[model samples]
Target: MQYYKKDKDKLVCLLCSYYCKLKTNQIGICGVNKNTGDKIECLVYGHISALNIDPIEKKPLYHFLPKSKSLSLGTVGCNFKCPFCQNYGISQEKNIDKSKYYSPKDIVNIALQYNCDSISYTYNEPTIFYPYAKDIAIEAKKHGIKNVYVSNGFESKEVIDDMVGIIDAVNIDLKCFNDKYYKKELGGNLNQVLENLKHFKKNGIWLEITTLIVPTKNDTYEELEKIAKFIKDELDIYTPWHLSSFHPDYKDLDLPRTSLETLKMAKKIGEDNGLKYVYIGNVPYENSTFCPNCNEVIIKRNRFEVLQNSIKNQHCPKCLYKIQGVYPKMKTIRKTGFAGSFYPQEKEEILKYIDEFNKQITINGSFDTRAMIVPHAGYVYSGFTANIAYNICKDKKPKRVIVIGPSHSMYYEGASIALYDEYETPFGNINIDKEYSNNLKDKYNFLSFDDNMHLEHSTETQAPFIKHYFANTQIVEIVYGKMPFEDLSSLIDEVLEDKENLLLISTDLSHFYTQEEANKLDNICLNAIEKKDMSLFDNGCEACGKLGVKALIYSAIKKDMKTKVLHYCTSFNKTKDASKVVGYTSALIGY
Candidate 1:
């Protein structure tokens, strides 16, 4: 609410550190706040650019509101100019679209509609639109909803003072400890952010800190030690620190990604300095909470979901030591969405269907199946074909399976990896190989935990089959939207280096057509895969996962692996309706 003072026909704005004195029709450094005649007005007061329901852990807040969802909202402009900003498309741009306007009442209503426990101001700099967020926070408190700020921690004293009673928690980005990097690379002052850290803790707000550790920029052991020391000495040692991996994005495309070893080193340093809790973000790791006294695992985490927790009533069950963070009062379960919709949900019926399909599969001499290419559709049409390939691979007794498919619902840049601890099926939950999944993401900048992977049928459809055959083996699911063929092939080769790892590619050949037309189109794709011919992909293959198939073929040819076609069929076989049908096929790749 602190705005302007008129002095000799000029307006002086004191909202942030950059107290700009503006003439008529002049804007501040934030680009969204401007002076109009007598007062400073925010151009994006009621406008919203992005909104969604996100897990509180995804905001990297480990110490506050664990295992809950928040209604997140963001406007258009930002004050700082960080080159490696992830949300630069909306944060750095000044083109405001007024069509998507939501008042304070509307925001609180949307939060209640989504069953969210809190409202988060994130994605862009929340300080720029502080007026709008303040109103929403006040209204949300009336409805028993908390307010959070995912900010850069560069606010002025007036702003933090105003948020004393309203803002319940904050996850601030302590980008780096070097003043030169903040001045030259981020257009910010390091001292200001450090001062805000002490202010936030002094005001008794739940404070958590995050640092995006870029590779050669701020990932040195010495620099990391200073950051850890400051948090332990200046702020309380109980403050949770989140060390996130940086992917090359926006204006910094040539920089290398942060490695897993670096994150591990930072975590060790934070612990050595007496910090209670430290977590690695963006890439998966053993990111769980432990009791500081007894070293017992209090809470188990797999990406954004909390798998298992032993913290009872905010105290460790083993040692009876008190834990620092908030714990959920009730148990939570992640349900299966594709069970009743795509196939049978009953266990006996599902086992009967798999048994019937297995009876039709003819497995010859034991083939060491390292990888497989299968189809994903309704069971009546594609189940028999998929069963043939799964039967062959099941003989190998692989310890872990990696499933890759194409995305149909959302568009993302790289491949999306599933972050859930266990995938649900009619039989039971299948354990996920979290260590291998984290290594893949840490080694390649093109892999991330995208929410779209949760809604994708291409990967989820294969869960029941894998669970039925490889009951004890772990699984890793990946979905690609748009990625380079060579990049995926490279990742495949890396994964296949371990002979115990099995790769499965899911796709359906040729959409709706006559039986004759379906076979003609399906045969071309099958022949190309069989012959290891990359050029055959250009001959109208019509496979929905042509990119993944091509990548599999390319990697197989490079590794000198053999390909075998197990079976091929169509939906016409089940319905006896030849007018419109979909093609399905199965194949295997091994030594």
Candidate 2:
């Protein structure tokens, strides 16, 4: 609300660090604010350029409302000129022809209607529209909605003073530690931004910092260390630092995307500097929060989605150590498992059934196995066959398991990856390996997240067996609806190259056929799998996961891995129903 005194005919604006003085009918450096007649006016007032319901985690505010959703809105125009602006279309543009106007009261009502716990001024610099944001935030507070600012951290002392009471949280972009890059490249002052960061923290705002680690720019170890140490020293050790990856965008099209290795190194530097909460952004699976006391995983996240939260009453469940964040009143625990149906929900009964299945199968000698193809039918029907494969590969003890199966209930292209933190079974929870799963999604454009695909029994049925055998290993489940075999093969090859990954293809042979006919069809599939032949699918091998099986064979053959058939049976073996039966088979692939 502060404007400079009129000197002669020019009125000076002091809202941001630029402090541009304007004449009559002349706009400030930020195109949205102007001097008309006697006063400075925000030209884009009440004009909303972008609005959406987004997870607070996407703002990279891990320590503030960890898993809640916020009604986010942003107006056009920014004071600074960062070359690698991800939202440059809206942030860098000065035009306002396409923006829609929403009053402060109307914006708060929309946030309430969407069940948002907070209102975020994001996508563009909120400082330029401070008056508008202040009005909306004041209105929002009446309805018990918090206010958040996702800014570039170049606001002046007057702006921070105005935001003291209205703003509840903020994510400031601390771009780089180098003052030269801040002034010459980004057209902003680094020291001013750093001083403003301390001001926000001092004003009782829940502050978090984000630094986009652009390759060959601000990604060096020395620069990252300096930034990390500054956060730990100026801000509290509890303040969260989010290191985001930079992609080629806007004027920085020639720069390469930030590598995973670089992001990991930056995270380590922040941690080494004694910052309690450090996270990697723009990269999946690396955004989880851990307790500083016990180092236990407290909140698990996948991109913008919260997979699971183990923190209860803002304390670690394992150590009862207090965590820093604004948490919801009620804690949510995800209950996973095929309870009361697929397998017995009763602990005693499920353990007994697994023990019986183990007795029925004979364990082969230990071998260096890399992958396996197993059936996913009822435990009574396919348990013995599946057991044989797990028993053969139990010695390999791969650190991560990838389960690929056909999606029976939903139809979608490519493959779907489950975003759950853990897949629960009667045996135990199977932790989803987020790092590898996210890396796969990054490498292959075909991989994505779909809740419906994860509901199918094909992939879910394999979890209990994996939990019982590979208890320490993490799992990644992929359900494909109608992906091409060649694309599937390429995806499999990518997983196989990682020596610690154990791939499991889930499929039951020939559904609903006579015992004799099922045998003939199952044998065709068995021979094809052993021979690594992709042509067998053309001959009508009736396996539900024929595409996945073909992909395994194609990749296995190329890697010179050997395949072995462990066991083969049918539902007839359990029910004695010879007229109608489904075939079951198990095999192991190894180098």
Candidate 3:
């Protein structure tokens, strides 16, 4: 209804450069847009075919929000018919009506629920679904979340005008420089893409360019240099140009995969043409960002993972040279998603329980209190067990506390690090050690930002206890899923090397079992933790946070830290329900 006009007896689509003229019931070049006797109908308006949470680097956007997570979205349609399209299954699919619908509000909520820094319209030509994308972008901007467009540079001037403030960043594919080659091979005009690239820059949108070097098609020296020079002259020299390799897919099966040498050559040409940040993708290369002035490695990356980023305050530490492009803003607050359900939602009530529990516990003599294993359940059921560890460690206060737990809701590989500035709790707000969290993420490849996994009660249940005891110390949360013991243990050992840091591992043992049976299963866990024997855990030592607990045990053994069981109980102790009881325990690991 927005970008269409009635021309005589046909409808003209003004959303793209083609300005497609269609009769009644005729579809545009993009298969999803059709003229239905009255107006242009977007067939895939609410239909989303693919939704994924990916690193910002996976968008091949090196300069935008480095080390942040983006919610990627794709629909089933395209404006071009490139034979060598990497995502042709979705881009070229004809039956797009089968996908489920998610409203614009649904998408915005999903992005927020996952703690995404941005929403990326990727994997296909986003112009084909501009109506859906525009609505989502408008909603996303209201929440301080940015929008990205990974396009083929065919959006009409009218669409660009409409998206001037809504779209924040774009990674447009410049394909090639030759007009004849573009028309014959990609069904697009090269000049149109060139003009749109200039328009995006003129409109103040953060711009990056990509060129999938398809073997002999766009890998020649002449074409690569021309494309590189245009970026320097038309767009600014600071615009990042990504030279990616192409593989044989869909109808382009005869061509060989783009060679590493060709990609390197393109990178050299871009550098020679005065481009500041030229990166090679789809290959094994040191795709790191260097300071243009001093040539120091400011940001080190391994493929999609950032290994180390030394850009302090968005400037190079060595020379204080200011880097270009968008960086992450660490001001998010982890909302209390499970406050009233898992724990108290009022500060007064939480403090009353804390005071009552403190009156019943005393610190054992000279226990160093380096780390703890505490139960995560409602305060009424396991508060005494969990309170024992917190009470013991209250005097030996550390500068920071790292809370590790298992994710019970979402399933994802590796671990999710909470990058928020503050974590919410009924006791009060605790400042998250964002600098330390970023350092760990930079040091390891397995840690990433996946905010949706943080909503689990496994970690949220510990926030109130942390805020109550460690009132001044900062907090860092790590929620793991499908991670190996060695990986997590290695991280634990690293954290313990700093004597001023406290580690809190949250877990609950043996669910919904009879009290008699739970004691047998829970004792095994208690013994294994006390003895620092990982072998005993495999013999039915059940725990919802087994991975975190096991990693702590392994780290304690490696560090020669002794474990002491402070308190142990079952839900039956409070509810008198022996038939279906849950086990809870608390322990301290120290010298």
lDDT score, candidate 2, position 416: 90
List the global CA lDDT of all models.
0.86, 0.85, 0.89
Each model's number of backbone clashes? 0, 0, 0
lDDT of 2 by residue, 1-591 (tens): 565567777887877888888999988777899889788899888888889999988887877777788999888899988999978888888988544678999999899788898999999999988988999999987556899999999887888988887899999999999999999989678999999999998888889899999998899999999999899888889998998989899999999999999999998898888988988888764678888888899888888888888988889999999999777655222255356666667668767877887786666465567888999887878877888788777666777899999988768999998766667777767667665777788888889987767777887778877887887788889999887888989999988898988999999999899999999988889889888776776786899999899889988888898888888999999999999999989988886
User: lDDT-based ranking, best first?
Assistant: 3, 1, 2
lDDT of 3 at 442: 95
- Regions of candidate 3 where Cα sits further than 4 Å from its true position: 330-591
Task: Give the Cα error of residue 400 in candidate 1, in Å.
Answer: 55
lDDT of 1 by residue, 92-139 (tens): 989899987798999998997887988999999998888889999998
Model 2: residues with Cα > 4 Å off, grouped in runs: 3-8, 329-591
Question: Using alpha carbons, what is the TM-score of model 2?
Answer: 0.55
TM-scores, all models, native as reference: 0.55, 0.55, 0.60
Best by TM-score: 3
Candidate that would win on lDDT: 3
